[model samples]
Target: MDFCWSPTDPVIALFVPTDADEMQPARVSLIHVPNKEELKKKNLNGVRDCKMFWQSNGEYLAVLFNQFNGTRSTNYQRFAIFGIKDPGIPLEDFELENENDMIIAFSWEPKGQRFAVIHALDQRQNVSFYSVIKSHNRFQFSKLVTLEVEQAGSLHWSPAGRFILVAAMRGCGGDLIFYDVDALATLAIERFVATNIEWSPTGRYVATIRTLSDELDVRQEEFQEGVMIWSFFGVLLYQIPRRHFTQFWWRPRPSPSSCTQEMQDVLEVVNELDIDLDNDLDNVIFFGDVDNEDTSFHIIYRATFHLESTRGLGSVVDRDWTYDE
Candidate 1:
């Protein structure tokens, strides 16, 4: 065992890095939160490595493991899914049939119905998708796509099982490949692509971090910041400036275009409402660039609202002076 938990599974996780036999066997384990009694089993997957395991569903315990198929890891660099359910009890897995090495990187579907895996094939990249069948107790290998030397890169499935976004960095700069999973074989490609992609929570937008450096003139390092907000159909909505690492809304509710009147006629009135908890004059807002060099500076946008004390100013004074009503 090249890996063991430092404290316990409760504190830090333990990894084997490589199996005793395969050295690195594309390992993955799921600790499906089980009943307190059922959680104590150590040999369910022919391994007692996990601190606790539970059933993600009625039939599966989600696992994360360190196993390499001898393709990527010096010790164990590959990860996989193992079903810790019935008959075989432990190590009972739905292995990738007729494959030498398991894919180095993979992602599970949001709904947990499917997962996507890309593997090493013929000195090339091949992406394979697996659909989870709960009733049948198996993972159905559904779709497969193969690519050349540098094609099959930056592949990500949408949050739902709608489509997959892939970037192929082959001959030219690169390409964004969109494959509609529902349409079947309908592929759309966007030229000049980059990586580190994220689809918006609403599933309408995609964000990717890309370096805009020159490929040939690598020494001419002209680094700038940018963020591209793209639509589902690959339209450039806007490439916002990355000032202070700005964030763009990937998916906003679709609405009619904004008009000039739609912009709020922001009414700002500044008056001293002297209920001064901490010199409530501080609550008085100045709208313009009224920079007081002594105490205040501009960039104070506006004062919207304030809370007032119920006590009258005269009574709150608590002084010896008497006033006639």
Candidate 2:
């Protein structure tokens, strides 16, 4: 079973796969939260797996189904779009021109009317873009463009939209491509053995992470575990090597108006100190207070003296201080 919540509405979508032994068909349902009502329910046959995607505005929901051909022993893909806000919650079914092509990745453009899919056939992969168009009070899906990509298996869209990062990860050789949707141009192409890709909340930076597992052989050079930070245009900003690195997360930032006075004061002090934690170690001078009783008083005195020294009243204070009791 899998479920997803609508970003902008009080709706939740649920999917339960069919059980061959129990003789049950796959099911999908949308539930309205506040009123505890069932909005829509759909049953499907021959489905092996289902994935659900909600548009940024919660206006529509896309369901991708992977189905198997029992006779051919092959798998194919189909997708359905549901107009959540429309009357009766209408749904439209769609499939690729080649039914045998398997979809490897899918993404909805942030706050936009389009989505992209990476589909593969016999090892050759291509990324296709589609737009959801509304005409005559009905919604339609239109294919925009399809581009052949080298081992591309995943898509990461910028938070603010317009840019996308196409990457080939794990067994796919770790190739990276940054593309501009509006200009139909490739911004930068690079390589990294990334197992995961993330875009900064502000859409200004991207982080390609390579995490290693014990089950995989780590003797290969490409299996190095670390994180690489890149600019929106794929410029390499910083690369930090971490042993056994498994996870990465971005810190959330609050708006300027939400800043408290204490927070602003801390920022001012940090800026004034101008400490370079990574490179200023050589200039650090340590003052140690060994007596337990006078430690606090000495710390205050030393801090005051250090601040005065910065103004030419005494010698310059070191960036570090040590206290012992």
Candidate 3:
């Protein structure tokens, strides 16, 4: 079972696969969280897998299903869009013009009435943008534009919308393309051998990370595992090399209205503490005075948090530290 919650509403969309031996069709449903009521349900056959994507504002939900053709030994894809806010919860079905073209990635523009799809055919990949258009009292998705992108495998939209990062990660050479939707122009193009890409909550910065796995033997000189921070415009700001790096995450910032007076007071005190990164012995609090080299310690440092003055400012610092498992 696969499920996703609506960002702006108390509705959850779920997809349950079929049991082939039992001859049951796949099912999709939307449930109201408060009342535990099912708002919509649909059953489909020949579906091998299902994926659900909810619009940022909870206006619509798109369910992509991968279907198999046993006779032809081939696969195709189709999608259904559910209108969440509309009465009766109407659904519209759609498929690609060329059903044989495989879909590589899909992403909805944040708080926008558009979505993007990366489809490939015969080793050629293209990114297509579609807008939800309203005409004659009904809404439908209309193709806006399609661009051929080399080795594009994924899409990452900014939190504020308008800008999108098209990247080809893993074995695709980590090709990065920053595009502007409003201007319909390519902002920048760069490359990094990243396994994962993520945008900052404010959409000001993006981090491209290269992580190492325990099972694989990787040459350090060939694939330097680390994190590279870049601006939204595709400019590399900083690159930090970390040995055996496994994961990276951005700290979320709460809204101004949610900030209480007590939280602000604590942040003010935290901002006053000085951080000295150069000296390891100074300004460091050791948990135990054990002289053994294997002993682990927790060190706290004052870091800067990017926020308004009224909200207070502090960030968690990441450093090379040994910890007990």
Maximum-TM-score candidate: 3
User: Candidate 1, overall lDDT?
Assistant: 0.41
Q: Give model 1's TM-score versus the native structure.
A: 0.50
Ordered from best to worst TM-score, the candidate numbers read 3, 2, 1
Backbone clashes under 3 angstroms, per model = 23, 0, 0
Tens-digit lDDT string for candidate 1 (1-325): 3222212222112234335574343223323233222321222223323222232233433343433232533322222334444444333344454445445455555544556555665566666666655444544344444433245554676665567776643223456766665554545667644435767655565665444444422222333344565655666655533422322222122323642332222101112222343233322231122222222222222111111222222111121221222
How do the residues 230-264 of candidate 3 rate in per-residue lDDT, one tens digit apiece?
A: 87888887766666666656655577789788657
Clashes of 1: 23
Write model 2 residue lDDT over 1-325, tens digit each, in one string.
8999999988999898889673988889999997879999888777867999888888889999877666637767898889888888888887887888888888899889888899988878898888888866688888877888877878899988889999987654756989888777889988656778878777778888878854443355657676787888989877656666666555345677998886686455545665442233211111222222344345435533444354332322332322211
| Candidate 3 accuracy as lDDT | 0.72
Q: Which residue window of length 10 is worst by lDDT in model 1?
A: 264-273
Model 3 / residue 265 / CA error / Å: 3.2
Residue 7 in candidate 3, Cα distance off native in Å: 2.9
Q: How accurate is candidate 2 locally (lDDT)?
A: 0.74
Best by lDDT: 2
